[model samples]
Target: MRTILYLMILGLGMSCSNTSKKNDGIEMDSEIKDTVTTESLSTSRMEADLKKKGYQTFSYKAGDTTYLMQQYYMVFLKSGPERSQDSTEAAELQKQHLAHLTRLYEEGYTSLTGPMGDDGDLRGIVVFNTATQKEADSLANLDPMVKAGRLVVEVHPWWVAKGGKLK
Candidate 1:
């Protein structure tokens, strides 16, 4: 009687374990299907949105590779902590710096300019609508911040969509 009881318990435990494994496999399959469905939905939505925006699918791409539409200048701003005499001077220089940037924008020299968030060593970036690095460098040096030694700029050539023209 004892041997029979032990065999019955072992069989019952094995059956339960097999059922649990089957349920887990079913759950995993469901999760995989959900993930695939979500990814396909996201991809289709992105393609539709791009079409709605009047952008041609192949305009910036060559097969699987993407290419720049035009060449422009990118200026990276770096902090110059030792250049300021005091806080007031730094503030004043910053004010002048903004004005200088506005002037450049109005003159069609700077296409875009913005400050980076307080996260890294990069202070800001200025995009210039120029074909050569020398011209961009000269223009960037005109900023009051650069003149006051409160900031320094490094210029590089960047190529992107020609559609990125400033209004």
Candidate 2:
């Protein structure tokens, strides 16, 4: 049929358009056999790339399907000029706060924690490994800075890849 011939021509044109140039500046043949060869070569190249990045082939089975353990929490602490305590009192509270955070880090309750470089109203962030936002909030509230009303925190539930853990 004429319609079938037209469709075949369109398909051929699309396939020809898909022909790409390789990194070596060579134009590969637009044939099925050439594509199969390229794919096999690509698989080996991919394995080499993964190896270069220190990736290893492995598998594990926990026998548990729960995903709550994978959940993380973040606290965005906003800096404010209005404080219930004086400047000297607030400085003392901040010192105690830093020590408190150090203790939490040693205990593995917090993973990545640090203050922002700028002196903006948005001060710092604390990434917590707790299972729930409530738990993370309770821990954040335990800080002397937050208790003295020098820093306010907005807690948020953070979802990240399980393998993307830094520690």
Candidate 3:
């Protein structure tokens, strides 16, 4: 019976891992966050080298470059203790900002990018279908992190697979 109880508790914990968020004035909590930083100097060099193999790289904007194997949005968020600011106001601000992101996710914007900050703050990345820079910019406007000064959004184009042109 004890073993069964432990198993039940473990299952409950896993099931409750789903994060909750608020959109505009609506609250939601169904999206599990994904945090992966796919950008590194080695990754960048590999991406650049891929172009030489006839894999084309294109700019989402006139000067912007996307180096990921696929397209995604990077997002960052920060709070008081992790931010080392001792500012409750900052924490409150971040919550409201995350709420905005919750709204976007609710609206079906799933490709995400980032480990939001330099330290213990919540950070993660999500990948999705390719979107234009203009589209990204529009997303930025609605993004809670961006609005809260907790995130910076960049539209990066990338190849969908090894040895393939950026889609």
Candidate with the larger lDDT of 2 and 3? 2
lDDT of 3 by residue, 1-167 (tens): 99999999998997666544457543324342212123344456776775564444443322222334544444333332223334786677667766766666667664443453455544544443324545545765565545555554544444454334434
lDDT of 2 by residue, 1-167 (tens): 99999999999998888767789775646575576556556555654564464433222234322111245788999875457687888778888999999998999789889999998888899998775678789999898888777888899877654446465
Q: After superposition, how far is residue 8 of candidate 2 from its true place, in Å?
A: 54
Candidate 1 overall Cα lDDT vs. reference?
0.73
Best by TM-score: 1
Task: Determine which window of 10 residues in candidate 2 has minimal summed lDDT.
Answer: 60-69
Q: Per-residue lDDT for 94 in model 2?
A: 83
Q: Give the least accurate 10-residue stretch of model 3, judged by summed lDDT.
A: 30-39
What would the per-residue lDDT of candidate 1 be over residues 73-153, giving only the tens digit for each residue? 899988765574688988888898999999989998888899998956689999987646788899899888887777888
Runs with alpha carbons beyond 4 Å of true place in candidate 2: 1-69, 165-167
Q: Using Cα atoms with residue i matched to residue i, what is each candidate's TM-score against the true structure? A: 0.56, 0.55, 0.37
- What overall lDDT goes with each candidate model? 0.73, 0.73, 0.50
The local distance difference test score of model 3 is 0.50
